[model samples]
Every structure is written in structure tokens, then in C-alpha cells.
Target chain A: MNIFVFVKRVPDTESKIRIDHKANKIIKDGLNFVLSPYDEYAVEEALRLREAHGGKVTVFSVGADEVNIILKKCLAMGADEAVLLKDDTPETYDGLRTAKIIAKVLKDKFMDYDLLLFGRLSIGADNGQVQTMVAQLLDLPQINVVTKLEIEGNQGTAYREIEGASEKVAFSLPAVLSAQKGLNEPRYETLKGIMMAKRKEIPVLPLEDLGMSAEELAPLMEVVNLESPPPRKAGTVFEGEAEAAAKKLAQFLHEEAKVI
Target chain B: MVLVFIEVREGKVKKSSLEALSEGKRRADDLGAELHAVLIGHELDELAPECFSFGATKVHVLESTLLSQYSPSGFSRALKELVEELKPMVIFFAASSMGKDLAPRLAAWLNVGLATDCTETGIKDGRLTVVRPIFAGNVFATMVFKASPQIATLRPNVFPLVDPVDAKGEAAKKNVEITEDQVKDAVQEIMREEGSELDVTEAEILISGGRGLKGPENFNLLRELASILPRSAVGASRSAVDSGWIDHQNQVGQTGKTVSPNLYMAFGISGAIQHVAGMSSSKVIVAVNKDPDAPILKLADFGVVGDLFKVIPPLKEELKKIFAD
Candidate 1:
């Protein structure tokens, strides 16, 4: 069995995103990028599956050269290899196109592989749409936000958290699975693992080399504006006894805000 | 034109689809394009009337036994076939578990672009600009797809559901066939979870506890309140869940379930952005924390500054009185 996990290098979540005061775009300087935490789960799940099934796990990413740092983290966590789809990102791009480039590059390989996986959603883009789109492109069966998994022979059972309930789904080999956080406690890079990761492979597959055309999949949307949410006013305060506070709060909702 | 995937589970429509339809209607109107809906199910004609009420002019239904249970290949094939034929301007899917599985596969097959979990969307100059939180809701990213059909998945509960003034409409019958090969890999069994004492995601009202309740026994007040409110459920912070005071299923935060209920009551909880991201969309948010500086109070519509041990029981009693009367 083999597992391929997709990863993305995204801006750290806490960076104060600044819309260039004049350029009408986001300023990319001074920003730190990391392996999307959700994808971390994907990598961990793959490692866990490989541990049980006896196979190699390959991790892949789509972004600039810096993305290798994030990919290396996967290797450090015990993945067998890493592939960086190196392309200088434009000021803006779509997840769907990202999925296409990934699918085009990995489809043939995936056909040979037993399983393909990704994080439930990326923390950077926060649009969990890419992995699913890739699964669609590959025309493979996919299970999303799988909470748990078990292997019996060639078949695997995926447990997904559905609305108000949990569902167990079984799929044969060669399926796509998107993992949510807490699926497993992603192991940290131990001293031994870090030393061994240096010997692992990190290959750069150019988008053009992969034979995917950005122009073939024409984009449908463009960003006219970029800005952070308006800062909220500091909240008001109230001090009093419990019963009186409750009465006042109720009065406020009913008479003032009318939200109750 | 916009193509919205209408999710039909167990014969009826899920609440998230209504939000998708509403979002689709707005996007279609903005783009000056037709708003079409695709419903794939085992047998879903009974849901046609409901789909139209959400502003779908045309309903494409693919009836098949394979769809009775979810199969990714079948869903992707059905959607890929539709996308090829309809050539929608933008595609909308709710970022529920099912949509998460369906959207990417279709986008991949079509060789298009997609934005997932878009918190906000607007069309300007024939382009769809989407905004979403990044870095675990630590920052916001405004982005655009440089791909066709502008496929994007909207997070459920993030977008407000619209009640169209004249919502009544008729759906034209759509005859589409779904083959067994299309829906490969079946969900053989569903290890159904036991009935939840509090699942805030689907609840109309949520009572979430934080670390301030002091002890697990203190949750009695919150539980007592939930029993009387038929639509209410209880939730807790990650701290509470990890503390063994509550189940992880009841956790509501960045790492937990996001909810937008009619009412959200926070007891002994400080609002973290991760915490706020999950439930800030609620119609009304009330917090009862001892500290005035609690983050939860910043966004709350109503605030009660007091001790939870004393505040919760009387508040529950008052709620009982108001509702029982």
C-alpha cells in the first residue's frame, strides 16, 4: 500500500494581514508560512496507516520553494518522500486550479498508489475545497473529515462526523480521504527522525514540467478588494449581583437591542 | 449562471443547502445569470417543490440506488456531467461534510478553480471575490480564483439564509441517469453515534460552558436549562472538554463545531477568537462570565457580569418561568 498526502504552505494565522495601502493588494513581506495544520493530520494519518499496512508514504505540496520547509516537516515526521510542485504563486490564485495542477501531476501515480489523502481544510486559505476538488478531478471515491480509520486486508473503514451523528464508510484500495484535526496526535520530529529526514528525498516538480496549463483552466473570479474585518468597538461592561444582572441583561435584549 | 448543489439526505433537504441556495440566489442575481440546482439522490422528486422555493429555476435530479448511500465516484461523475453540460458561471456548495467531499472532485475533473469555506463572496467586474479566515481564524484572506466556473464551497452557518419575498416557485422536471460505476465505493455501515445530550451545531439555542464553572458538577444548572428548552443544546470550551467536565462532542471553538443558532448563551467562558469563530454568527449571543475583560463579552449582544455558581440557576429558573408561562 502507498499513501500520498497533499500539503500547502500558507501564511501564519496570526499575522496582521495588511492590504497594501496603495498597491491594492496584500503585502507579502514579513509573513511566515507553515504546513496547514489540517494537512498535518493528513500526514500523521498516512504515517499511522503505513505503520499498520507496511508501505511508503509520499507527501506533496503546491507553492513556492519555501513550501519545502513545510514539506520537510512531513518527512521529519516519518514520511518516506516529499514532492514540491514549485511554482511562483501569483498575487492571487484559485484552489480549484491548485487542485488541477495537483491532480494532473499525481493522477497517474495515484492510480498506482493505494490511497490519497489531504487535510480536511487548510488553515491558511481556510477553504477546505482543494482536496475535494482534486478527488473530483481524479474521479476517485473520497471520504471527508474522516475522524477515524481501520484497515482490514485491502479495504479501509473511514468514520466521518456527520450532522448530529457519526457515519462509518468502507472503501476499497485507491480511495481519497480528507482528515480533520485530532484524528491523531501528529508526532513531533524527534532528534533521530530529523537526522534521517535529511537523507529522504524532496523533488521539485515544476507546474509546467507536470504538463498543467494555468491558462487551460481559466479563472472565473478576481479579488477587487482585500482587507481585514473592521475592528469591533471595545465591549461595554456591567457590574452587579447575579439576579439583578440577569434582569438587566434580559431587559437590554428585549428593550434596547431587541435581539432576544 | 450559478450551479448550486442541493444536498438531500434521507429524502428531505438539509438546512445547509438552504443557505447554499440563498447564497447562490444572491450570487446569480449579482452575476445576472440563471440559478440552477442539482440534486443527486436515490429518489428525490419529493424534494423538488422545496428546491424551487429556495429560488432554483431548474432542478437536475439523478435518481439511483447507489446514491441512497454516499459514493464519491458516483457523486463526482453526476456533478461532472452536469458541469460539462450546464457551463455554470460559478458553482456553490455548502462546506458540510458531503459538500467537502463533492466539490473538490468536481473541480478537479473540470480543471477549474475553487475557493473553500468562503465566509463572504461578492461579484464585481464579472469576477467572484471571496473572503475567509486563515491561520485558524487569526487572519483573513480575500482571494479570487483564476479558474473557470469559479467553484467555491461556502461554510455552513457563515452566510445568512435569505427568505425570498416571493419564494414560491416551480421546478422543471430534470431527467438525468446515474450509473453504478459512477458511484463506486459505498458506505456499507453507519456506526451511528448515541443521541447527543447537546449538539450545538444543529441546536437553535446553545448553552456553552467554559472553565469558570469551577467543577463538573456545576454543569447541572446548564443541563437543567437544556432539558426545558426543546431547541437548546449545551456546549463547552476546549478547556472544559479536556478538563473532563464535558465531552469533546460538546466542545465549540476553532477546533470544535461552528454553530450559528438563534441564541447562544456562554456561561463562565471567556471568548477566544477560536471560540468566537464557531458561534459568532448566532442571532443573539449572551455571556455570563465573572470577569468583565472576558473575550466572549466583547462580541456578546448581552452581558451578565457575575458568578456562574449563583447566576446560572436563577437565570435557568427565570427562563423556565418565561417559557412555561
Candidate 2:
């Protein structure tokens, strides 16, 4: 029962953004990067919790070298392995130096892992607070965003959703959840799972060749500029009966859009 | 300075934290500094005179009982010790669900610079300049913060909550020591959840629907015109909540819930930029949509092309005959 997950590569959230004027930022030429639509619901909820609790699912990222083509597309949506923490100008929308470089590249693989997953925010910084800030710098036990998950033996639970209800929360078995885009519906990779993810295996490292440091994960907070916005002004067509245009749109929401 | 956290929950105050306390008193009076706010949980002295009627010149208070249910690592360690003793410049919070889980760990323990959900803000020579809408609003990003304690998270009814241009609650606060043993995220109880009472941005009327309201029991005809208006609330879109016909918290655009209510009424909804990023700062967006070129009718301000079962039961019988005359 290992898990890990954590993905990232961003910038293709339909990239039409520009703003580089000498590195003020976000002009990453042409765009098209992927693998972060909220980490495909945390790599499909860690491949459906290792296909209903059996074991194995790994995955990690820091990116660049085109994040090995989105970690082989999360090894074709099943993830039994992959690491990729390369880093070369991997300024990754700086969410706390990308969660202190995924907590210093998983601080000694967090005691061989028991569970750690993210993706409840990150369309390149939608900020779902980095899997509870890497479970608060590895102090652990975080259940955030969830949307559902179970497990029994070591007691897990999850659920989350918050703000208009849905909590559940139970935590125990080496936690850290996050995952949230409706929590499931991810899949998409078939063709016999893309011919068995073209023979699995993803590895690749370089957090100072695994020893780590880039100022032990730099970035206090950046992105001085990234731009793209300014185009919203043409609207005013209220014609005909839908109850007489809801009465001149209820009198333009009450006298020239005063909003009732 | 600007600290504004204020999220009260079942005890009042949270019309998006009074638009994050009037955008943290307009970014602390646009950097002339000082505006505080903060209010964590518990009885909160009746939402502290409505955070001094929304100009919170100052008002720290951390009200405990482990801040009665809710612990994003104990509200980001009581806002990272009041942002290390109020080193604010900007720190709005209220992207909801507890400022999207305590504004990125209080901007990663005050290292600074953050821009979440934002949806427009400006300051200029003193920085702040926010505006955020990505992927779900189809793109619009404009950020900045070279530091000076800049942190944002707004996006709840996109600003508009003034009231006390500073009548009393003057500038000068203190009480903020927090305990429950300086929580590290342990609420061992409360899984309680009773939600559902139309609060899409404090609903001032909203009755959304989409995918032509063909399933999930036609969302009770958009909840019968949101139980007959008077601060309505029903919403849908994201193709009727991914076609389950509703319940993705009654979805709405841009990854849902960005409502600007005051009359949104979109039925058989066709709009999609994730539902116009949750309502295009709504306020009169009426779109009925029989497909008069549906892109939520270019952010409607009024465009009933036609047919939500003949336009919502005669506009819910003309709003129950004008609130019964």
C-alpha cells in the first residue's frame, strides 16, 4: 500500500496568455503542456486506490524535459510508477516553490510512503493549498478537498467538499488527500491502456542528483507578471417576449443594473 | 496593511466575508495602510458590529472553541500569527471553503505574493493589481506582487460591499493568540453536514438550469423559480452538472459558484466557460437560451431567446403575481 501521486506540468489551460516582455513571465511560447487538469483527479484517485486496495501507484513531478510527456501521461492513466523531478527553469507557477519541491523531493521518500496525493487545485495555481501544504511540511494527517475515498483497515474515510456541505473526514493510514474535481471520472487512456503504457517505468531525477537543494526548494512567492485579460464590453441585446424580456430585464435589474 | 479573513459560517457574516471586508477596505485604503478584520469563529460578538459595518479599520479577535469546527491547520495557524504581527499590505481571503483552505498556507507562511480567484483588483504604483480567471473563464490572468505582504483570494461576488466608510470601528486592534494547542489540523469530530439553502453568493435571486433541463427531474423546474424568488438560488450549467441534471452544488460557471446575484435566472443554460466562470460577476444576467447563439448569450444582461418549458412557468406565474401584489 504505497501511493504518493502529486503530478504537475501546467500551462496549456488553453494557453493564449503571453506577457514575457523579458521574463516578467508567462510567455512560454506556444503553450500545450498538460497533465494537470487537477492531476487527472489525482491520477484517477491513485488508480482507483490501487484498483480497490491491493497496492502500488507512485508518481511525482517537478517537471521540465517536458515532464517526460506528462509522465508518460501518468503511465497511460494507471500509474504504477513514475517520478520525474528534473527541474531546469521549472518555476512551476510557484505555489510555494511548488510545495517546497514536493517537500524536498518527498523527504527521504517519506518513510516508504503509505499515502500522499494532491490535485484539488492547480490549473496552474488554482491553489487548493498544495495538498494541505505538503501535509503541513510533512507533519502529516491532512484530508482536504477529497470528494470521496474509503479504505478500511488502517481507517481512512475522506469525502471533504466543504462550503455547501459534505465532510466525512476520518483519517489515519498515513494521510494527505486533496484530489477534488468531482473526485472521479478520470480514466481515458484505453487501447489496452495504451499498449500497457508502452512498457511502464518512469523514474528520472535530479533534485541535485537526489541529494536535493535549489536553496532547499527556493521561491518565497513570485510571478511578477503573467497577463492576459481585457476584453469584456459588448453586451446589450434584450429583445422580445420571454415575458417581455422579463420586463426590460426587470428594469435592468432595477434601474440601469443596480442589481435589484 | 490589509488582513481581512472573517468567515463566521452558521453564526452569520459571510456574504463572502463582506466581499472580503470590502476588498480589505479597498486594499487598506489603497496602501495608505491599516484595515485589519481577521475574525475566526465562535459567537463572534454578533459578527462584531458587522465588522464595523464593513470598513474594519481594525478588529483582530480570534474567538475559539477551536474556532468551533474548521481547521485548515487551525486557520493557517491563526493566520500565521496574524501574518507575523500584521505585516499586511494585502491579504484578502474568501475564495470560500475557508478561503480555499486558508490562502495557500497564509501565502506559505508569509513569504508573500499570492493571487487566487481574485477577479479584478488594482492599485498600481503600490502593486496589488490582481485579476484572475483562468482555464474556466477561458483565460484572463493579470497578476503582480513584488512583495510588501501582498496576498489575495477574493473571488466571491467580486467586490462591492461598502457600508461604513469608517464610521466607528477605528484602526487599532489586538487579541489574537489562538490555542486548542496551536492546532496542527486535528478536529477529531464534527462530520456534520446539513447544507443546502441556496447561498450562491448570498442569493439575491438566481435560478439557473441547462442541458435543456431534461433530466434529474428537471431540477424541480429550477426549484420552482427558486422557491419563488425573494433571494432565489438554484443554478446549473456544466451541462446540468455534468448531466446528472444538478448537484455539483447546483453548479454554475467557471468551476462553479462565482455568483454575483441580483437576478441571474438562466434556464436551459448553454453558456460554458465552465458556466461563465460561475456567473460572470452576475447582476442582471438573464439568458433563457433556445440557442440564439448560446455562449450564455455573450454574458447576458438580458437575452431571453426562448423556451424553458415556455419560459419558466410563466416566469413562475409572474413572480407569484408580483409577490401577491
Candidate 3:
């Protein structure tokens, strides 16, 4: 049960995002970056799978040196090894190119694995395409937004949450799966694990090592512009008795909003 | 020509796919091209009329016994073959669960650029440009595809479904051959919810509850409120869903589902930034909470400062009367 989990560092969901209008990107200065919430679930699922099957879990991420923060965190969460594919391009919003790089590495270097995992989507780009693209590039079976999973031998069954139902899917081993919420409650890093992770050195693979250049992995789309959504106007607040306010709200919805 | 992928579940075309067709119609009109819709499944020719009514000039049915149930490899390969033969100018998909999973694989197969969850798609300078919400609705990014046959997914409920017209269109049938060896993943069964519940992304009105609702049992109040409103679905904040008060499918937040309903009613919700990013695009918002300074109050078009439990009963009663009239 060799499990590989793909992770990304994204702005904390709680952080206030400021745009750099001049560059058509978000201003990252002073913003807190954390492991994407969905990726945390993926890492935890990898750890659990390793614990159950008695094998190793390795975490992989593609970014600049700053991505080490998230890789270290995953190591502290009980992953056996961590690797970083260096891409110094300040902001790479192309999920397809990223997927291509990861798939190439998996094909050329680490071809033997029981499972490959990813978050449903990266929070910053919110494209949610990389996992499926990687699966296609590698010609492997894949499932996304998985909530429940069971494995035995080389056969795996995953439950994907659809609109109003859960689709049960069965696939062979060496498949790709993306973790959705409610998969499991991720374990907090123990003090001893944290101490060990602080000293462990993670191997970094430069893009050159993979025989790929930035130009070859150029994005498929260009960001023309970015703007903040218009702020909602302040509305009248009804502070009277509960019954009266409720009635007033109904009246407002019927008359002013005209939604009813 | 523009190509739109229509998703069918239980032999019925999904409303979100219709929304995608509506969007494709607009793009076709803008580009002065024909709108072509494809349904890749068995016994789907019956659903072609809905596509024509929504402005499809032609409907293509690609069916195979192996393609009856969605196999990521099978469906994507079928669509890839169709795209190769027809060579449409653009491809559109609704950002539904199936679409989200299938579109990227097709894009990779075709080696084309794709924009996901787009709210605005149009022809600018004779090329496809799309605007999609990124960072959970905090930022909107305008993008231009750099390759031929631009591919994109439109967010549901954000795009309006055009009025159905009594127009006729041609239908083409093609039998796809998919070997069992190609379908590496297979769907075993589907466990549906007890009732036919609307997905939050497709609901016109969303009645959402939060931690202030107290517990899971209290969500019945929200269910009752939703019952009073037509085309309404019950939603929950991430906190409520994380607290195990509701299913994650009903969650509306950055980490959950992003919704742009006509009206969003947030009750007992504190409106964390992540939660706000999901529903801020809604046309109108109404918040009911005891704390006057809750962040959701500021973002809502109507705010009621009172105990939700005390307010909900009267609110439901008042809405019932209003609808009764």
C-alpha cells in the first residue's frame, strides 16, 4: 500500500485577499498561507491508508521554496517522506501544466504505487482539474470528490457524493482519487512528530531534473484582468420584537424584494 | 458551431445542463454559429427535444451499452471521438458533479485549455473569453483561451435558462464502441437520498441554517421554512455541516459548494468570510440572527436582529400566509 498524496499551499480561507491590480493577481504580502483544507483531508487519508495496509505515505507538492512549509506540515502529520518539484514561476494558475509535470514524474520515476491522491481542487485557482487531467495523462482510472473509501488487496471501492446521491465506484489498484470533505477528521501533529519533522530534510527536484522547462509548461489560458466583487449594500435592520420583525421581513420580501 | 454537453440522470436531462445549453445558445448567437448538443448515454434521444427548445440547432446522441453508466474513461473517450469528427468552435459544460469530473479529462484528451465554473462567457474579439470566480468568489478572473475549440464549464443558477421555444432541430445518432478493457472504473450502485431533493447549486431560493440553530433536530425548522417556499432547498453553513448537523452536500461555503441563487436566506449564521464567498453572488440576501453585528447582516439586503428560534416560527407562519394569499 504505497500511497502518494498531492498537496498545495493556498491562502488561508480566513485571510483577507487583496488584489494587485497592476499585476492582475492577488497581493500575497502579509497573507497567511496554509495547507488547502481539502488537501489536508487527502494527506490524512493517505496516512490512514498507510496505517491500515502497513506501507509508506509520501506527500508531493509543486511550487517554489515556500511550498516546503506545507510539505513539512504533511511530514509532521505522519507522512513517511516528502518531495518538492521546484517551479519558481511567481504564480502558476495552470492546472493542466502542473498536472503534466506531476504525471511525467510519476511515469518516469515513481511508476509503482497503489494509490495517488489529491484534493478536489486547489483553493487559489479553484480549477479542480489537475487530478482528472493527471489521471488522463497517466491513462489511469480516477474518481473525484470522494467521501468514503474502502480497500482490500488490489481492489478499491470509493463513494463519491453527487447532487442528491452517493455513487459507489469500484476500481483496480494504482488508481487516482480526490478527497472531499467528511472523509475523516485529520489528526493533529503530535509534539514528537513535530520535533522529528523539524529536522528531516525533504528532497527538492528542480524542473530541469524532470527535463521540463517553464516555456514547455506554459499556461493554456491568460488572466486578462481581476476585480473584486461589488460589496453588498447595507440594508435596513429590524430590531423590534421577534414576531414583529418576522412579519416585517415577510412583508419586505413580498413588497420590496418581490422575490416571493 | 458550439457544442454543449447535456447530462442525463435517471433518464432526465439535468436543469444545470439546460443552463449550459442556454449559455451555449448565447455564445452561438454571438459567434454566428450553430449550437450543437451531445448526450452520451443509452436511450437519450428522447431528451433531445429539451435541447432544441433551449436553442440547440442540432442534437447528437452518442450511445453504447458500455456508456450507459458514466465511466470516466468511456464517456470522455466517446466525447473526444465526437469532437474530433465534428470539430466545433467551442465546448460548454455545466459545472455539475459529473461535468466537473468529465470536462477536464476531455480537455486533456483534446489538449485544449478549459476554464471551470465560469459565470460569464462570451466572444470577445472573435475568440472565447470567460470570467470565473476564483478564491471562493473573493476575486473574479477574466480569461482567454489560447487554443482552438475553447472549453469551459458554466456555473449553474448564475446563467439564466432561456424561455423554451417551439423550434425543431435535427438529431443525429452515432453508436460508440467501447471495449470492457477501456473502462477501468465502474459504478456499482447509487444510494439516493430518500426524496428528490434539489442540489443547492440549482435551487432558485436557498434557506440556510447555521450553528445558532443549536443541533441537528432544530434543522427541521429550516426544512419547514424551505417547504413554504417554492423551488427552495435547505442549505447549511460550513460550521453547521462540520458540526454534523447536516450533510456536506447541503453545505454552502468556500470548502463546500458555491451557490448563486435568486434569494439566499441565512438564519442563525455568523457569515464567516469563507461562507460569504460561496453565496455572495446571490441576487438577494436576507439574514436573521440575534446578534446585530454579525457579518452576514451587513452583506444581507434584509437583517432581523432577534432570536432565530423565536423569529422562525412567526416567519414561517407569515410566509405561509403570504403564499396562501
Which model scores highest in TM-score? 3
- Identify the leading candidate in terms of lDDT: 3
Off by over 4 Å in 3: A213-215
What's the TM-score of each model vs. the native? 0.88, 0.35, 0.98
Interface RMSD for candidates 1 onward, in order:
3.0, 11.5, 1.2
Give the alpha-carbon lDDT of every model.
Answer: 0.74, 0.70, 0.91
Worst 10 residues of 1 chain A by lDDT: A216-225
Deviation in Å, model 1, residue B305 alpha carbon: 3.2
| Distance from true location, Cα of A66 in model 3, Å | 0.8
How far out, in Å, is residue A107 in model 2? 1.7
Question: How far in Å is the alpha carbon of B301 misplaced in model 3?
Answer: 0.7
- What is the per-residue lDDT of model 1 for residues B1-325, given as tens digits with 9 covering 90 to 100? 8988988766678777889889999998988888888888666877876777778887887766667777667777777877888888889998777787777677777766667667788997898878865544444567777667787778776677877554545554444476666665666666545657335776777888989988788777788878877778888887888788976668886667767677788999988666776676677788888888787888877777788777776776666665665
Give the DockQ (C-alpha) for candidate 3: 0.82
**Per-residue lDDT for B1-325 in model 3, tens only?**
9999999988899999999999999989999999999999888899998999999989999988888898788899999999999999899999999999999999988877889999998898889999999999999999998887899999988888999999999999999988998987767788897753788888899999999999999999988988889999999999999899998899998999999999999999999999999999999999999888899999989999989999999998999999999
TM-score of predicted chain A against the true chain A, for each candidate: 0.91, 0.32, 0.97
